[model samples]
Target: MLLQDKVVLITGGSQGIGAGAALGCAEHGAHVAINYHGNSADAEKVVAEVRKKGRRAIAVKGDVADASTATAFVKAAVQEFGKVDVFVSNAGICPFHSFLDMPQETLERTLKVNLHGAYYMTQAAANQMKDQGHGGSIVAISSISALVGGEYQTHYTPTKAGVHSLMQSCAIALGRYGIRCNSVMPGTIATSINKEDLAQPGKREYMEGRIPLGRLGRPDDVAGCVVFLASDLARYVTGASVLVDGGLFVNLQ
Candidate 1:
């Protein structure tokens, strides 16, 4: 149990990669605080599953994109668990549109949730970790799109690139307090968020063809990396961006 007795907070944890991280953390004996913005039922489901594994779990409802709500969510977790050992900033949104025709609001919202949310969440969690007098880990969920810009995903790319940049900067600023910061860049993962598009035969084939691994990634694939980074096993690692992209990012020319 690499994370035995640790406390983890995962934002946007009701589904996709976030939900997967909650479960993985629980499996490793970490008490998980699952935060969901608009999906209380799904969040509850994850909480139930975590409890079934004999670990403490709770569902917290809040919008990570908002500063006040992110602060409150961190407060609630600390109230229940005494302290936060790991904070995973995984809340994000992606709506694709051609760069030349993308709406201003679309771009703003993407930055708000993907980049600003990470900022607020990390700020809130880092404060708590600093007060606890023990070093902690903060993992941000970036995307391979940040490394290799995607067509029609210009807005998302910048936000994710900001995440990677944030990780490096935070690592340096927070190192004095024993806090570590890192980012995980995931490739095409099979999640409900993209099920509609991936269900189409042509789109599915095109996505799979780009991966050298010959298959799309799964949520657990990225979750596994998140858990490792959050564990003591990665105590000496910080300011790093680990790509769980199945070689897709490398294949980009």
Candidate 2:
């Protein structure tokens, strides 16, 4: 009941961390508006699960990389739910490529989706919250790679670092309006995007050995942090980067 009756919109919410956050919000009595660029079936499944929790839920479709589309989706959610109380800018792409052979196309696309998408969605959502005369929460899903550069994530990690900076800036710029902004940096979460890589022989064991928690993170690990930031309990917790990495990055440092 931490987010009772709050309206939350999550982009790329059909699967992985996004989907997990949507369900978590619903369980806490929040209405979820899930946005998915593709895979209508996955979106529908998430919507159904949210409804099963007896909370209002809807699935929206749009490419978050398009500023207009991202803005429109926020408006759509506001129109459906009356007003957005929370916005989770969780849509992003992570493609690992060594620095030497990283293609220009890959780098550009990663920046567009990971950084630009969050930028637009957050700006639009913040404007809506300001116009409504009530404060709201914004949680951007970043990565631990932002703190510790990965060997194969040269193109990817920069975008996440940008996301953290973006969150802090938004928090400062919008604090007067009672808006809160923060980022969640997840580490080695098991998601469809990285399942193949993590499932490589001996990979799981090696990763677990490194993490103090001795296991890979789950999507719900990040989702739980997002819900806390979205709730009034975190009212004084703006401009913070909540790490959900199970001590992987900390131990390394």
Question: What's the count of clashing pairs in each model shown?
Answer: 0, 0
**Which pairs clash inside model 2?**
none
Residue 201 displacement (Å), model 1: 3.2
lDDT of 1 by residue, 67-120 (tens): 898889898998899999999999988887899989999999889989999999
The list of candidate 1 runs beyond 4 A from truth reads none
Estimate the overall C-alpha local distance difference test score of candidate 2: 0.92
Q: What is the TM-score of each predicted model, taking all chains together?
A: 0.97, 0.98
Clashing pairs in 1: none
The Cα local distance difference test for each model comes to 0.92, 0.92
